[model samples]
Target chain A: MTTMKDIAKVLGLNESTVSRALNNHPYVRPETREKVMEAARRMNYRPNTLARSLATSRSYVVGLVISNIANLFFAEVTKGIEEVADAHGYSVILCDTGRNPAKELKYLDLLARRQVDGIIFMSGRLPAHVVAAIKQQSCPVVTISRDGTRHGIPTVRINNRAEAAKATRYLINLGHRRIGFISGQLDDAESGLPRLEGYRAALEESGIEFDPAIVQEGDFRMESGMRACARIMQAAPRPTAIFAANDEMAIGAMKTLSQLGFKVPADVAVIGFDDTAFATVVTPPLTTIAQPLRMLGTSAMEMLLKLMAGQRLAEIETVLECQLVVRASCGGTGL
Target chain B: MTTMKDIAKVLGLNESTVSRALNNHPYVRPETREKVMEAARRMNYRPNTLARSLATSRSYVVGLVISNIANLFFAEVTKGIEEVADAHGYSVILCDTGRNPAKELKYLDLLARRQVDGIIFMSGRLPAHVVAAIKQQSCPVVTISRDGTRHGIPTVRINNRAEAAKATRYLINLGHRRIGFISGQLDDAESGLPRLEGYRAALEESGIEFDPAIVQEGDFRMESGMRACARIMQAAPRPTAIFAANDEMAIGAMKTLSQLGFKVPADVAVIGFDDTAFATVVTPPLTTIAQPLRMLGTSAMEMLLKLMAGQRLAEIETVLECQLVVRASCGGTGL
Candidate 1:
C-alpha cells in the first residue's frame, strides 16, 4: 500500500501538510498542492485518487437509483448491491426517486454532475428524454427489474411472464378456477404487460377462460389494490383466489378483504409478487411469486461495473428466475 | 447560471477542449487546467464546484448516518432531509449503516474522505470509539432521533419520555391496569432509557405497580417483540395490554398474539411508537405514539446546515413533540 506518508517522506513534507495539500485545503499554496498531487500520483497512493481521477477518469463511486426507498424490496436489493460494491472498493450513493419520473430525471442529472462512475436504475418509470439524456452523456447505465427502453442498454430482471404463469398455475392446482388478477398499470411495459401475458397463458393452458371482468388494473399501490379487490369480489362470478402483481397491492387487497369480513384462503385466497418482508408479516402470510430481488440488484451492479470497465459484453440482458413461496394465504399445498 | 461555453469564449478554446481543461483532463497541460480552474472560479459556475472545492473546501454534500435504511422510519426521515438539502443546493448521500456498528464507523470515515459538508446520524448503537473519532474530525454533526454523547454537538429529537408516557397512559385509560412493557436494549441510550422512564412514569401515575415479570427487554426488532409477547403472556398474571418501545416490536407482538389465539383490543390491547406504515397496515391497525419523523429529519438537517454555514446557535438542542394515533387496535376511547 503506497500511503500518503511515503509521498510526504519523498517530498520532505509533514504528513498533515501532504494530507492538507492532497485534500485541496485552501491554506496550502496552489504550487505546493500541485507538487503533492504529482508526487502522490507518482507514488501510486490510492487516496490520491481524488487528484488521480482527474487523469484516470474514474470516481470509484456508483449511484443507485431506486423508485421508492420506503419499499422493503429496494432495501434488500440495496444490501445486495452494497455487498458486491464494497468488495470492489466502491461506495454507493443511494438516490431515491420516490417513484416520481421527474425526480428520477433530476436525480440522474445530479448523479451525472457528481460524476458517478456508473448508475443502476432499479424498478422505476424512465421517460424517453431521460434515456436520451443518458445516451447524450454516453453514461454507463444498467436497468434492473425494469428494462431500459434505450436500445442495447443492459438490463437485469426476472422472468415476469414465466413467474406469473407459475404463480397462477399454483393457484389453479389448488382448485381455484375462478382466479382474479390485480395487475400493475397496463402501460407499464416491463412488469405489467408481461405478467398479464403469463397469467393469461396459464389460464388458457388450464382450460379456464380469461375474463377481463375479473382483471382489475391497479396503479401498483395499496389503495389501488384495495379498490381492485372490491371490484373483483363484486364481479358476476367472484374469484376464488386473487393474484396481485406486487406485495404492496396484495397486502392492501388482503387488508380490504379482512375489513369486508372475508377470511383469507377460506373466503378468498390471495397471492402476490415480490415476496416483500410484509408478505410474511401480514395476517395469514402471503403466498406469492418471489423475485430474486437481491440477485437482481447484484447482477445489475455487476453489469454496470463491466460496462464501466469497458468489458465486451456477452449478454446484454440477464434474466433470472423467480420462486413460489407457499404460505397460509394460499391455504396450503393440499389441493 | 454561468455556462462553460462562456468560459470557452473567454479562453478562445474549443468547447470540448475547455470542458477537458475544466475537468482536469491529463491531456491538457497542468497550467491550462489551472487557468480554466481560475476562470471557472471567477465566473462562479455551479458545476465547477468540483474544482472550486479544491480552493473553497466546500463539497456541498451532506451524509445521513442511519441505523437501518430498510426501516420505513428512516425512509420518511430521509425525505424530510432531502427536501431541505435540495433547497440549499446540497445533495445527500444516504449512508445506511444497516445496524452494524463497524459499518457505521466505516461509512463515517468514507463520508469524511468524500469531504461531505456535514453529517446527520439517526438512531443506532454508536460505539465509543466512533463517537471519539467523530469528535476528533471537528465535523459539523447533528444527531437526529439519536443524541450526541460527544459534548456540545447539536441534537434534534423527540421527547421520548413524554411520548412513551402518553402512549402508556392511553392503554391505561382504556381500562387496562396490567400492562406489559416492551423496551429496547438497556444500553442503547438514544431510545431505550428515555422510553422506559416514560412507561414507568405513566404506570406510577395510575398507581399500577411495575412488575419485572411483565416487562421484557427487546432490541427494537420484530423478532424480539414476538418473543417478548410470548414471555409476557406466559406470566403468572398475564397483562391486559402491551406497550412496545417501537412499531416493529409492537407489530411483532401482535402477530404472536394472534397466533396464540388472542385478539387485539378484545383480548390484549397494544400500542406502539414511531407510527410507521406498519402501524396502519397491521391487523387491527396499531395505536401508536407518532413522532414527527419527517420534521425530525428536516430539523436536524436545518441545524446541520446552520452549523456548516458558521451560524451561531441560541439553542444547541431542539426537542419536538409526539402524537397518539387512535386506531382499531386500541378499541374505542370509552373502554
Candidate 2:
C-alpha cells in the first residue's frame, strides 16, 4: 500500500508539504499540489481518509435519512443533495427508512457511531422519540419539507397551507362549487392537516359551505387516493372537481373517475400536489402544485453544512414557494 | 466522550470483554452483550467506529455505484441493496453517476480512499478506462445487469437477448407483421445491442423481413423514446407494434402515439422493458418485461459480500429470469 510518505519520497518533497498538498490545503501552491497529486497517482498512493478524519474530527461525510427512495419526489430531492455534497468534496450516506421507525433509529445510531459531520433528515412526520434521539446524538441536523423549528432545528420547506389553498382557489375559479378534497394522513401535521385546512379556508373565502361528507383521508399513496376518491364520489350531488393533497392521490382520483364513466375536466376536474414525475405522464397530464423539490434538498444540505461548520444560522425556517401548474386535468391549456 | 474502558470500569467488566460485547463478537455471551449495551446507553457511549475499523483493517462499508436513482428501476434495486446490507450490519455509500464517466472515476477513487470492503457497480456501459481503474484499485467488485466476467469480475444480470426476443415473439404471436423496435444507446453492448439483435433474430425466425427503416436508437430516456417512436411511425409502412428497450422510452412512445391520435393497441400496440413504476401509472398501463429489479440488487450485493469474505464464487455470472407482463398497452386483458 503506497502512502503519502512514498509519494513525498518520489516527488522529493518534505512529508509535511506532500501532506498539505494531498489534503488540498489552500496554503499549498497550485503547481506544488499538482506535482504532488501526479506523484501520488503514479505511486498508486491511497490516503488513509479514516485516520485523517479521526485526527481532524471531521469525516467530510453527511448522513441523509430519507423516508423513501422509491417515491420520485424523494429521489429527485436526493439527486439535488448528492450534487451539492459532491461539489463540496463531501460524501453522502443515504439511509432510506421506508417509514419504519425502528430502521430510522438504527440508521441514526449507526450514523452517530460513524461520526458523520452532519445530517439531513426528511420524513413525512417527525416523531418525538426520533427527535429526542437526534438531539441526543449531538449531530447537526437540517430537516427538509418539514417544520423542525418547533424542535429547535433548522428547516427548509414550502408553505403547505398556502399552496393547498392556492390549488383550492384555482378549482373554485373553475366554478367547482361542490369540490371534493382527499387529504393526506391526519397524523402528518406538516403537510396533511395544513392542506385540508387550506381547502376549508378556500371554501369559506368563496362563500361555499365546507361539507365534511365530501372529504376523505388518504395515506398519501396512490391506492389510498383511489379508495378516497371512490368514497367521495359516492356522496349525493357528487363533487364537480377533486383536489388531492398530492399527485399520487390526484392520479388515483383520475383513474377512479374514468372507471366511473366520467370525463375529466368536463364532468369532473382534478388537481394534485407535488407535481412529481408522475404528474406529466398520467393521463391528461395532471394539474398540480409544483414544489421546488430539488431546491428543498439543496437548501437543507447547505444549512446542515453551515451548522456543521459552527456557523450561526440567519434563519431557523427557510420556506420556499409552490406554484400551481395548470394542465389538462383542470381544463387548462396545460401549456 | 464515554469510552469503552469507562463503561467497563463502571460495569465491573474487563475492557476486552466490553469491547467484544460492543463489537458483537461471537465468543461473547448474549447476556454480557446485553449488559454492556444497557450500560453504554445509560452512559451515552458513542463508539468510535473509525478507530475500530482501522485496527481491524475492515470498514464494514460497501460502495454502490448506480447509473441513476431517479430512474425507478435503479431506485427499487437500491432499496433491495440497502435492506440486505443493513441486515448484515453493513453500510452502503451510494454514488449516482448519472452516466458521467468523469464522476464515475472520481467516485471510484473516493471509495478506494475510504477503503470500502467491496463495490456493486451498475452502468449502461462500462468504459475501458473505468475497467482499468477498477483493476488498479485492487477492490473486489460485482456488477449488476452487465457482464463483467470477461474482465474477471462476477456479474448478476438477466438475459437481455433472450428477454428481448421473448417480447418480440409475444408481439409476433399477436399477429403483428410490421413491428418497430426502439433500442438503448448503441454503445451499451450489455443491454442495447443484444436487445436489438434479439429483435432482429425474432423477426428472422418468424420469416418476417427485418427492415432497418423501422428501427431507431433511443438514449433509454422518455424524450428519446418519443423521438424514436415518431421517426419509426413515419416509416413508409407504419408499424403495428412498437417495442422499446426500456419502460421510460416505451412510455414516451405511448405519449407520442397518443399525441398522434393513435389509440394504444387498436392503432399501434406498445411493449416496454423494465416494468418500472411508470409502467403501471401510465394510461393503458404498459406491457413490459419484469426484470426482478430488487432481486438484481440483492443478488449483486450477495455476490460482492461473498467475494469480500474471500469466498470462491461457484459461478462467474449469475443470470436471473425475466417475465413478460401483459398489460393494456399490448391490448391484453392487463391482468
TM-score of each: 0.87, 0.94
Give Cα distance to truth, residue A215, candidate 1, Å.
1.4
> lDDT tens digits, residues A1-335, model 1?
46778988998899889988976788998888999999877764556334444445576778888876666778778767876786677777777777777877777777776677898887466667767766655469888876673466778888889999999999999899999999998898889988899999999999999999999999878899999999988888788899999988998899889888899989899999998777877788889888897898788888888888899679889989998899899897745
What is the TM-score of candidate 2? 0.94
TM-score (0 to 1) for chain A, all models?
A: 0.84, 0.93
**At residue B278, what lDDT does model 1 achieve?**
80
Q: Itemize residue pairs with steric clashes in candidate 1.
A: none
User: Alpha-carbon error at B133 in model 2, in Å?
Assistant: 0.6
lDDT of candidate 2? 0.89
- Model 1 CAPRI quality: acceptable
User: Model 1: residues >4 Å from true position, as ranges?
Assistant: A1-49, B1-49
> CAPRI verdict on model 2?
medium
**Interface Cα root-mean-square deviation for all models:** 2.9, 1.0
In candidate 2, what are the lDDT values of residues A198-277, reduced to their tens digit? 99999999999999888999988888988999999999999999999999999888888988999998999999999998
lDDT of 2 at B186: 76
lDDT of 1 at B3: 68
